[model samples]
Target: MQTIKNLVKDNMRQYGMFIALLLIMLLFQILTSGILLKPLNLTNLILQNSYILVLAIGMIIVIITGHIDLSVGSIAAFVGAVSAIMIVNMHLPPFLAVILSLIIGALIGAWQGFWIAYMRIPAFIVTLAGMLLFRGLTMVVLKGQSIAPFPTSFQKISSGFIPDIFGTESIHLTTIIIGIILSFLLTFLEVRKRNQQTKNGLEVINNGLFFAKLIAMVTVILIFSYVLASYEGIPNILILLLALIIFYTFIMKKTVIGRHIYAVGGNEKAATLSGVKSKRVTFWVFVNMGVLSALSGLIFAARLNAATPKAGNLFELDAIAASFIGGASAYGGIGTVPGAIIGGLVMGVMNNGMSLLGLGIDWQQAIKGLVLLLAVGFDIYNKNKSS
Candidate 1:
């Protein structure tokens, strides 16, 4: 019993997320008459949640730095508008348009970063103003209208699946193969890393902990891969999104800069005293958010095959909800990439399930509101308990 307690304490963050995900799934499965676990519905859940996941990652970083970005949704709309204009109206090459739009996103981030970091303005006010400003700007750019029927190639960024050149029909063997290889490779690397830690005289976790984690990961991957492989091939956007998740997870886990960012979020004065460049870190965080907002915009436009003035309505709420639901603190200084991902999935699943049941949108939103309140309440409780 003591060993089990110690094991849980040692990896509480990981286990907490895993347990939360399972609990949520179970709750929804029971509520939705088990349709929540159906393979088709699960696939839909992933696709729907993909965008919020993108924004949640950015929002988590922003929140980690003790900052809020109310403008992400507006930025997403603006970026989507810009991408549509560049590709469809201006007749630019799709790939080049994408690249340029990403730069524009970076520039947007730089714009907000400058005001917040160098100007010493409150992030809330800046981002709030930006939220409104960008929404209006998006309208102007889109001429108070919606632009649709973007090129097929561009549309595929969000709506298309990986090509299945090697498949006979109905299944993409390549995707399954990729999933299997990826699963084993990831497992192998984890084992190798732990073995290295043991050799270095580091405090290696008990073998039980390692096995528990591995079993959890393999189960998740196999289930996810099986669902996707059974669908219309793996969604390209999901693949790209997963790659970004892995890359950012590594950045947060393995990089000093990532640590500094979190420290700044945890305690600005302490981090500054410790020789950390809090300003630069905050600036980069916003800049990174901008870039993601841009990518999200392009993907949104592509997915709808239309650029609407309301492209990212309420996206800020979704992103914030994802972060907190994933275990971020309202006061900042905690949260993980995987946590944000799970949070996104949680919201995604709820929305998908509610919609499938033909529940009134009002009820769907009411439930989400209750969930958000509960999540924030949990954070406060945890924070006070720790204090």
Candidate 2:
């Protein structure tokens, strides 16, 4: 009994979000009479949420540092507009424009980061000012007009799927093969990680419990692959996003920079006293946010094959809400990439499901708001109970 209780306590955080996701799907699936889980529709869910998921991953890091960036939406719009202008008017190469747009995004981050990190201005104020500044700039750059018919090469960023070397349309055999390998790789890594933890005398869960989680994870992945493989081939955007997740996850989980971020979030003064370059960390976080924002802008632009000053309106809200819903503390010092991904996906799936059901936008907005509230409220309740 004690072992079971302890295991439950240790596993609660991991299971809570999973349970919420399942409950959501069940409720929506039942209400919609099983329309939400159709394989093709579910695949659509992944494609739609791809951009927000990317933003949420970056937003999670920002919130974890006891800060927020309110200018992401405007920055994305502004950068996207710039990319569009370069291509449509200036006749710049699409790929070159993409690079230049990203550089501009980095510059925007440097501007805001300088204020927050070096001058010690509050992040909210800095980013808010940025929001207004960039909004106006985007409008001016776009001339209050939309740019359309972006290069097919650029449009493929969001609309394209991975092509099979085998040249078949049913499904990419390569994708299936890759999926199988990934599952096994993931399982192997988890086992090795748990064993390493044991060797290091760290508090590690029992082998059986860990293996159970491994099985659960791989099973879900396989099921998802089966669904997507049954329809279109793997999405390249999804693959790119997954690569970003893996790279960033490693940085956060294994690198000193990641440790410093958490340390600063936990207590900035303490972290500074411990010799962390808090300013640099904060600066880089913004830089990263800027880069990801640009990437999202491009994805959205590509998906639509158009760029408008209003393309990413209110997206900051989505990113911020995703972070908080995924267990980011408004007070900082808490969040994870996986949590952010899950949170973003929850919002994404909700929107997709509602759209599939032909629900009005207003009702969809309300439902999303309620879910956000519940998530944050549960987070607070959990924190209070633990404390």
Candidate 3:
């Protein structure tokens, strides 16, 4: 009993967030007369929020390192514009255009990193300049017009679904199978990790609580899979998102570089004294952010089937909000990729639910602002209380 109590105490924030998400979903689900979680709506929710989720993934890393990237939205817009020029005007291959766009994003990262890492400019000012600069460049490139009709292959990056292999006319069998496999695999990994911890004489969860958690996870995945199967097979972007989540979670929790990033974010001078190349870590983080931002740009453009000068407007805010709502510390050194994803989903669900209720844009904006404020306030309260 004591072990379970201690475990729950230690994980209060996570549990709280989980419950809050469920409550919000339930509230909206009721308000929308069950429209919020309908099969089609769920699929739309994923598509609508995919870009924000990608940006949140990168933005959390930036915040983790005690920095911010105001230019992500503009960078995404700029990259999308470039992709349009390459594929539409130059008639370049869609594949080549994507590769070049990502490379261009990396170059942009290097440009900003040189100032931030080596020249020691404040990140806020640097990225603020970047935001204006990229937005201007996007306008110049697009000439205040939208470019459209991208190649079909490129469109699949955002709008396609996995081909159903089982040929089940009524349901997507492949999606269900994949979900079951994932649930089992995740449970096995958790149990194995617990055994490893015990072997190393580290604290381990009580077996009963551990199994309970596993059961909860399995149930959620099965339900989610069912929802997707009822609509269409798993979306291509969903697979991309899952892969990114798994990869980043591993990097942040298990890798040397990940530790260094956290250390730098925690205390730059102390991390430097410990031989962690703080500058290098910061540089690579921005580079990673650039790549992700570019990827988001491509995905957004694909989904819209066009590149517009106004594309990605206010995207950075969504990503930042997601990071903070997901429990990223303003002071850095604390956040998780999965948490950011959940935060993005929360925002997405709210947007979808409110739209279904026919709320005005003004109301939506105001409500979102309040939600962001409360989320940050809650985090600050928890920090102070813990201290």
Ranking by TM-score: 3, 2, 1
lDDT of 3 by residue, 1-387 (tens): 888788778886666567778888999999999999888999989999999999999999999999999999999999999999999889999999999999999989888888899899999999999999999999998999999889999999999999899999899999999999999898889989899999999998877778888998999999999999999979999999999999998899999999999999999999999999999999999999899999999999999999999999999999999998888988899888988998888899889989999999999999999999998898888889989
Best by TM-score: 3
* Of 1 and 2, the candidate ranking higher by lDDT: 1
Candidate 2 vs. truth: CA RMSD? 1.6
lDDT against true structure, model 1: 0.87
- TM-score, prediction 1: 0.95
Measured against the true structure, the TM-scores of the candidates, in listed sequence, are 0.95, 0.95, 0.97
Best by lDDT: 3
How accurate locally is residue 316 in candidate 2, as Cα lDDT from 0 to 100? 93
Model 2: residues with Cα > 4 Å off, grouped in runs: none
Kindly give the number of clashing pairs for every candidate.
Answer: 0, 0, 0
Off by over 4 Å in 1: 200-205
lDDT of each: 0.87, 0.86, 0.93
Q: In candidate 3, how many Å is residue 156 off?
A: 0.7
When sorted by lDDT, best at the front, the candidate numbers are: 3, 1, 2
